[model samples]
Target chain A: MKLMIYAAALFAGMSLSIEGAIYGELGKSIGKLESSFYNFFVGTIILAVVLLFFGKGSLSHTFKAPKWQLTGGLLGIFYLTILIVSIPLVGVGLSMISVIVGQMIMSIVIEHKGWLGSSPSKIQKEKAAAVVLMAASLFLIF
Target chain B: MSILILAAAVIGGVLLSAQSSINGAFSKQAGTYESTFLTFASGALVLFVGILFFGQGDISAILDAPKWQLSAVWFGVGYLFLTVLAVPKIGVIATNISTVIGQLSMGILIDHYGWFGGLQIPFDWQRGVAIVLMLAALRLIYIADRKSALQKKQAA
Candidate 1:
């Protein structure tokens, strides 16, 4: 199970990287809204199919998501918009550096407090420092 | 403007953190498909409102988007699946660090090689050294994870 989790993390990283590359290409031709529209549309189609075929639940399960959970979608829109907007203005390297810094700081708070109903874990100093080091590396690379 | 950008980045980070936490909880409770679907669906609705209220572009442009551009939707699918599967297991920081590293590495490669539609950058010693440092940083973080795992094992 632990191995599966780690594998999932690696896969997630690769998937996101590929997505960023694809988005970079798309940003050239389409406005951010249209790009995001197509993205969400395709994602919805794929997830709908998966739910219909593989998921075992009634229609209610689809709509039964909690109110707070909807914030995830709002955040997605914000993140995507800012990312697209920032990249053009700041360059990919700088925009990404900003994003990494943001992600690291927020992730520590989120994980430590278990905000949003996640399992709680305390923030360890070493791990925090490691994240900071990673962020510093972004400055070097970008 | 730089200060504003920095502030926005910080706020964006907090939002992302909250989103990640919510996503983790939803994934655990609702499973991948439903949670992913709901998130996208809700997000689409929000996007729709933005388009309706703030958009300046012609709606027809959506249809006129180039074939390659339209295909970018696949990236969204990949992102959804990844977030659902990864966040709960690895925790937010590790998952995000891995993602940032992967993105930066790929971005550099694309820029350096002019892969796909990427802009070419002259590869030089400084850039090479930077890549090395990024890899080293990633290694350090991954090692930290090993220590974490060892600690957990001892606790168990």
Candidate 2:
């Protein structure tokens, strides 16, 4: 558990710091659609090579999956474009604050409903406290 | 503008969390980087198809773009690996809170100096206090994690 927490700290700290700002700036110069397209374009080429050489996984199941299961890519389309545009208008910190809050609320809902075929976990008091702190931080962040 | 931006940010957040869990599940079947690769590959295909069907943007604009501006893809790769891996270990709350703290600090730095050509939004006292509180919450969450861990240890 301790080791996991430490690892999470290291990786989570690295995320949301630079990417949105960079993507936002790219969107500014090249347009959001084009910028996002290039991001995925480059990402695809690199991943394709890795998938071919390093991946032992098969895409057969992926093709057989339901349409909803495959919509992760569609979600990425919205997320990439939204962050790109939001950063320019609201600044990086505020934009991410919004993302955090959005995720928080929806997570609470997902937890309560167990919407995605997972076992339902009830929200504990400590989690509620954390949520309040996050909510308070949002006003200051904006 | 504020409303629109806030809505967009919220939507991005929801997607971010959802993808973390989804990709975490994917990591069970594939190598860590392999999972990341598959995600990007799928996303790329979607974007390409979107372009074919409805992207009204100029293709030349992307090709004509400067080289250095397209560096965020690597960051995407990094974030995805970390997110997919982290969620399984630390759960979503810890994963996201840590991510937000790092992102805010870096974001403030970038915004302070206007890095990456973004319009500068100078960091101020209100933002500072908010950040401090959020950091404190990290400690709070970690402590909770430890306590629960200890309880499990005792029960075991």
Candidate 3:
């Protein structure tokens, strides 16, 4: 059962990678903000009915949920816009490489601090070494 | 000048991962499409509100956009579907490793030819070595994860 979980996560990750590239292309096609908006538009259309049918939605909470919950959507907007703009300027490869570096750094801090409702975990030597490799790759890619 | 672009990319990646993590949590309580729908619905609301407040409210710009731009939604939808399937099967860490692999492989080709209108950067030995090393490190992490999981299971 656990192994199945790993396989599913791997699949999800791969799909995201493809989506990341597509987002860059979309950014080039329309522009960053529009691309993001369209993504939301299309995605909403795709799932709204199904979500309703599932009877699992709690959208009413949107009104009462803390201000922070609303901020979640902002993150998506920021990420899509940034990548879309950069992908054209830096090529997808270099763009993703740099992003990975940033992600590792941010993730490390998050883990160390246990911020965002996550449990704190220490970054081991191997983890630190992985960051080194990621940095070296970014430099080489440049 | 170049570093700014890289920095932007980094920020973008961070946001992407962060959103994914949060969405994964929502997916837990709600079914796959349910969570996805709510997430995108709220995203649309947030975007429209942000656009109205921060920038010109002229959303008509999207209508003039290219087919690819419009089609980009499919990828977004596609990603949500995959994660819905993957998170339940593989967990987020393993899923992330697969994503990096998928992303970089396409990234290399796209960068090499400047496909999709991105800046052209030919892949060379320097890039080759760096990518190899990065991938190696990722693989090591995956192995370690599996080993630890196995140990925990056995102990239990």
Please give the fraction of native interface contacts (Cα pairs under 8 Å between A and B) kept by each candidate: 0.49, 0.56, 0.56
Top lDDT hit: 2
Model 3 DockQ vs. reference: 0.48
**lDDT tens per residue, model 2, A29-134:** 6677777788878888887776778777656556554445556666777888888888888888777767777776666667667765444656656656766787
- Between candidates 1 and 2, name the one with more favorable DockQ: 2
Q: Ranking under lDDT, best-scoring first?
A: 2, 3, 1
- In candidate 1, the residue pairs with backbone N, CA or C atoms under 3 Å apart (3 or more residues apart, or in different chains) clash, namely none
Give TM-scores of the second chain, every candidate.
0.72, 0.77, 0.80
Candidate 1 residue spans exceeding 4 A from truth:
A1-15, A57-66, B1-14, B79-100, B114-119, B123-126, B146-156
lDDT of 1 by residue, A93-125 (tens): 445556656776786677677777755677776
Tell me how far the alpha carbon of residue B73 in candidate 1 is from the true structure, in angstroms, after superposition. Answer: 1.3
| lDDT per residue as tens, model 3, B51-80 | 666643345766776665466576556666
lDDT of 1 by residue, B1-156 (tens): 754665565566667767777876776667667666777888888787888887654546667766765665666576556765777777755775667666666556655666656556556666676656556655665666567667778989
- C-alpha TM-score for every candidate: 0.79, 0.83, 0.82
lDDT of each: 0.65, 0.71, 0.68
* Candidate 2 error regions (>4 Å): A1-15, B30-34, B53-56, B81-97, B143-156
Per-candidate DockQ versus the true complex? Answer: 0.47, 0.52, 0.48
Q: How well does candidate 2 score on lDDT at residue A74? A: 67
Off by over 4 Å in 3: A1-29, A53-67, B24-32, B53-58, B147-156
